[model samples]
Target: MTVYVDNARIPARVGRTSGRWSHLTADTVDELNAFAAELGLLPGWFQTCKRKCHSTLPCVHWHYDVTDKYRSAAIELGAQPIDIREMGALTTARRAALSARPKGPTP
Candidate 1:
């Protein structure tokens, strides 16, 4: 299970917040959550795409929007830092693979 971070320069200027931020994603939600947990991010910080909010819609991906400091820490900890273009393709493939899986029986 690998975690990925986009190489897009920090977009700190666009947001009202004070620091740069980056998206942290993984091949699976469990992997993503675990990595975020290692980063000391709370469970509440986990975020999924809008589609993931509804059962009928395809779940795109799960991620954590992390600050620049955390971004550096993530990379140091073995997260693959990738180009923004590559990041898009990676996420697209991850989403497709995730959505194609068969669901277990509902409780």
Candidate 2:
């Protein structure tokens, strides 16, 4: 996701400027909740999604808007910055493969 850093809150969504989904850093549920809550976000909204890395770290996935805002706050909160993309082609290719897969093992 493309991180947008600003001192004030973002007021609108603009095309092209908006970023893509990216992974999170907080490893545990508690860490995730604490971080999100600090930014005035509810715990329920913190979605759990797949990450390319295998780690105990509580990786989260958020839409571009949320990611941009949260990433900024994270930077101010002494969180490290990372640049990445979920890869559109990977998602599309994976979806197509899944759709082609059999519901169950062939007899």
Best by TM-score: 1
- How far out, in Å, is residue 79 in model 1? 0.4
| Model 1 RMSD vs true structure | 3.8
The TM-score that candidate 1 achieves is 0.75
Per-residue CA lDDT of model 1 for 1-107, tens digit only, reads 78998766576653565677788888778988888899898898897765554355466656788888888999998999988787778867866676787788767
Report, for every candidate in turn, its global Cα lDDT versus the true structure. 0.78, 0.46
Deviating ranges (above 4 Å) for candidate 2: 1-21, 49-65, 85-107
Residue 93 lDDT, candidate 1, scale 0-100: 80
Candidate 2 residue lDDT tens string, 1-107: 22222222334544544553333434344665666576666555555456642333332333223556566666776554544333333334444554576776799
TM-scores for every candidate against the unseen true structure: 0.75, 0.41
Candidate 2 accuracy as lDDT? 0.46
